[model samples]
Target: MGGSGLLGLEVTRQARRAGQRVATTFHTRRPDGDAHHLDIRDRAAVIALVRAVEPAVVVNAAYLQADWATTADGGTHVALAAAATGARLVHVSSDAVFSGAAGRYDETAVPDPITPYGAAKAAAETAVKAITPAAVIARTSLIIGRGDSQHERQVHALAGGAPGALFTDDLRCPVDVGDLAAALLELASSPHAGVHHVAGAGAVSRHELGVLIARRDGLDESALPRALRAGSGLPGPADVRLDNTKTQALLTTRLRGAREFLASPLPVE
Candidate 1:
């Protein structure tokens, strides 16, 4: 639903390019062009919007890391609305659902969240599954954009003498935003149901990812500071990698790794 965010914006752009009649939802900041202002926290509003749109498929990309009502309860509200309208649902999820205890997770791995955000995401996944059994609960890891993603921005800021250091021990499989959006769209139109792991091909530490980003953007990679997340008392997972081998087999779209995608500079706008 979040048509203004990076991944959501890419999804909307790709869908429009494919000649699909898309209706997007926004929360605080409205997206450019036409969009429905939807506060998914309100169940009745969610239902009303879904009914009004009468969409053939619904891709809910809206979420808040800190708000339980929005991430968990809001997801349920969306699911209930989508189920009632019989719309094919592709609910975007996060790898934060995992505790990183298992190191790697497939579609079958049960969520063991240690943080509030992770717990909320897990709860959302559970509710979406129970409400809409046919819905695709696509769980993903760190989403990396060419130059506009938060990670990229942080790297830029750090290189420019920002205080924070990218964690060297905090590992993730960062997927390209374009590839992830394409995969989500593919699953929306496909017959796949249940949980799916849609992530990049390889795993890299957050620091390494930042270095790649630095190089891609012509920054001094050494200028980016690094630290271990283990002793830093970060309340999140350390090495959660989504096993996308199974999901990759089912889709034609190739999910490129960060090393591959960030190897060369993107064309300047």
Candidate 2:
């Protein structure tokens, strides 16, 4: 539904490139081309939109990090609407659902959220599963894009003398946005049901990721400060890696690790 966001935009683009008639949605920011303005918080509106679109497959990539109604309850609303319309659903979830207590999480690992955002995502997963047993709840980690993602932007800002250091202790398996979107589309058309871990093959700390981004963007890596997330009082997990072994086997889309994807600089436009 979030056709304006990073992953959503790529999904829409790839789907259309493959000859799929796509109908996108946005919340606050309006996206280019044909897209519906949807407030998923309103159950009635969500249902009406889904019914009007009559899509064969529904992929919800919308979520507000701080809003419970949008992340948790809104996911349920989409599931309910998708179920009512008999459309296949793929709900995007996050590794935030894990507390990093297990260090690594597989598709079968139960969620143990340590932050509010994580809890909300966990709750959404539970609701989506109950409402649509056949729906795919795809949990992912940091989504890295080509110089446009938040993490990449942050690295650039730090290189330009912005304050704050990237955490060396906070580890994640950052996936390429294109790979993730492709994987999601593949899952949408596949027989896979329930939770799936779609993430990168290699795990790297936040600081290391920042360094890779800096090098790729032609910035000075030394300018990017480094710190430990452990005593930084950050209210999130320290190391939560998604095990994409099972899901990777089911799809042809390769989820490239941050090191591999960011290994090269962006091509000149």
Candidate 3:
């Protein structure tokens, strides 16, 4: 694994449980595992790391690098390294690759990103696919876990008397970090090696999700009123729901619904 982001960290943990020798990198806040200081953009460093580990499979959970070229080119580097070492690659991607203009996106959805972050991810996806179609490209949506995330912070602040507005227009299928990690790991071992969408089983608007969180935490729904409804004019995706039929059918672990994911009290590693 590369980078200790929420999903990356979860993937690392699951890999350990699967009895796979796990090696990860961290910019800061290293996890309780074998970690090293790595900058993915450094092709030589990535190549060296893979070569040193001599891993049978390489999973690039790290995306959204400091630079666009870093992510785009770094993906190419990782893919090439995997090919060079004959290691199967499992690359994590994002649902932001699709334009908001479309409805629910599935495995066959054509990527049409609208944001720089999304564009970088899309570019990296292309690079990975080009290098090896056998590589598993797992795309997901807003992952919720580890209250340290911006989304969780927003929920916390709203519950703690911080009045804010959440867009009602933005709809997504937010998956739990752990669930996504498990699915990706299963994909790594499965024969299906292509782009797959691993996200929450159900789709909910941002406002609805806020309401669910507020209710779960026993917060007054009136406190985050604007966040619970679509009113005025908010520019955001109406719906970016991901169809996980393929992911559910092929992976060993099934994704949890956003409500189930939030309601279940899982320890954040």
Candidate 4:
């Protein structure tokens, strides 16, 4: 569904690497080399594109712009369109679907979204599932990589010192974007349906994770600010570590932790 976003772009890259013909969508500021502009909010446009492509597999990595429209409603539109064409559907989801009231979430956990973005993602899962029961919904967590990831950007933002603090109470099992992309491509051809937790094997607070990354990347950990989460005004839960055993058992790809990935000589994906 999405062709230019982080996941979409990587999926396209890996798929092409594996020698599959590719057709992808873009939003505003179309990417170079024949990327089609797709306003998923316009259901007719979405349907037209899917019908024209008639791809064997459609992976939905589009997210978070117009949460209600692009994510929530857009996912449903893609599902309906893909379903009608009898294409296998792989929908990328988020662990934020839970309230963070608890942790170690699996496929069985009922969604209790607390934040607006989380609520929108939860809505998308609901609509996609109701319309396409056979679709695979991969609920993952914070995406971390070598370049301008949320973690790397936060580190740079705090290099000169920013306001507030890097959250120490909020926890997530950050996933390598490449591992996630690989797993999605594998599942697209499989029969895994409902929800699957695809994330890092280890759980750590954001502050802890930042410190680890800084230390591993040769940046001073002291350069980053730190604070414990203590208010309800915050957007998300205190914990959202995913149980990746299902994912591990399901695929040969191993989703390593930040410490593991950062420690590597060559960071893949």
Candidate 5:
């Protein structure tokens, strides 16, 4: 999977801390830790790796950068391989499965993806389900945490006083990367199967998220640009906040919101 990405890297760390022997796969970028080279698009590569690893649980955190071959088709390949091995599979997915036209989407909600990324993810989920009914499809939201590119961009925007609408009208349930990683690991061992909304308990507008991040970082909130997604005539759906109650009930983990997570003291390095 995408062990180089934010979630994958963190999942690797968390899984290790929990005393589980871990093995991760990376794409082109050389990962910071030991990892196997894998292009999920290559079905043979995926199967061979799975068989060699023979992991009790397979976590597919790998994704592509706007490429369908890996993003859309990759999950299917992993699911198929994991199915053949009879290993529990946890596939990381996105809330993009829901078109912003509607919000508070639940596990049972039919996917109406408005973006190509969403479509690809939805397609991957379908294929995974068909291939492995016992797999756990974790559809999460904006993953915000330290070292995350999006979080860094927001911080840089506030520090540089970047002009224009620091505005984001689309609503999302931004989840802490650590909390999400924990939830994914929990689901790996749980009996739950099918799609689950693994997101923060709080739902806020993108603009609000920026403000919260700015405030948390002690940046000039007044300088944060404010724009409306609808006002800007953005061509995509808005408000794809998810209902995480199902996941919450299933696991003891708590996925705190941006405001809540930000309010906590930055860890002393």
Candidate 6:
């Protein structure tokens, strides 16, 4: 694995608990438990890491969208690593890959991204598929769960009295971190290989989700401003909600709805 972000860390921890031999890399924040430092951008280093670990399956949560690039080149690093090692690769992706002009999207839809980040991710997906047809690409939406993910951070900020306007028009499917991790693990282990949508069951706007969080935590929803619709500032789809019918049928685990996904237990192991 590369880039030990929240998703990476969660998947790593799950794999470890399941008694799978797990080896991962870290760039900036070296995880306290056990992690090495390997920059995916360095192709030689990626190849070296793969050879050393000799993993049968590799789940790449390493992303560089917010920084180096978002889409095409961003995912190339991990794809190359998987090819070099002959490991089945599971590349986590995002709903942002679509323009958002069209609300819900499926694996078959042509990627038309409006943001640099989305375009980069789309590029990465393309590269991964070109090299390794069997490489799995899982696109999802606003993922929520432990360790200060965007969603958790927002909640924390709210709890700490941070004031901001939540956009009701901004829609997404926010899957819990744990549930997403489980789904990814299943994909890695199974024979299913292709682009999939691994996210929560239902769709919601940011403002609506904020209200749900507030209600769950007993926070004051009235304090929050009414939701508002906003544009991408670029030509693109609006909803871009993913259809997970394929994922639901293929994987043993069932992705939950947002509410149920949130109400579920946190990692205890």
Model 1: lowest-lDDT 10 consecutive positions: 25-34
- The lDDT per prediction is 0.93, 0.93, 0.79, 0.83, 0.83, 0.77
- Root-mean-square deviation of every model: 0.8, 0.8, 2.5, 1.8, 1.5, 2.4
Better of 2 and 3 by lDDT: 2
Q: Look at candidate 4 and give me any clashing residue pairs.
A: none
Model 6 lDDT-worst window of ten = 229-238
Instruction: Report backbone clashes per prediction.
Output: 1, 0, 0, 0, 4, 20
Q: If both were scored by lDDT, which would come out higher, candidate 5 or candidate 6? A: 5
Q: What is model 4's C-alpha RMSD? A: 1.8
lDDT of 6 by residue, 198-251 (tens): 988988877777667766656687766654555535343447688888788887
What lDDT would candidate 4 get against the real structure?
0.83
- Every model's TM-score: 0.98, 0.98, 0.90, 0.94, 0.95, 0.91
User: Could you tell me the lDDT of residue 209 within candidate 3?
Assistant: 79
**Ten contiguous residues with the weakest lDDT in model 3:** 227-236
Q: On residues 1-269, what C-alpha lDDT tens digit does candidate 2 reach at each position? A: 98999999999999999999999999888887779999989999999999999999999999999999999989999999999999999999999999999998899899999999999999999999999999999999999887799998899999999999999888899999999999999999999999999999989999999999988878999989999888787798999999999999899999888889989878676
lDDT, model 2, position 6: 96
Write candidate 5's Cα lDDT for 211-257 as tens digits. Answer: 77777667777777676776676655678889988789989999888
In angstroms, give how far residue 166 of model 3 lies from its true place.
1.2
Q: Show model 3 residue runs off by greater than 4 Å.
A: 225-236, 266-269
Question: Candidate 2: which stretches are off by over 4 Å?
Answer: none
Who is ahead in lDDT, 2 or 4? 2
Per-residue lDDT tens digits for candidate 4, residues 113-229, read 888888889999998889889999999988886665777778767855776567888889988889889988988878788788889889988888888777766778897888778
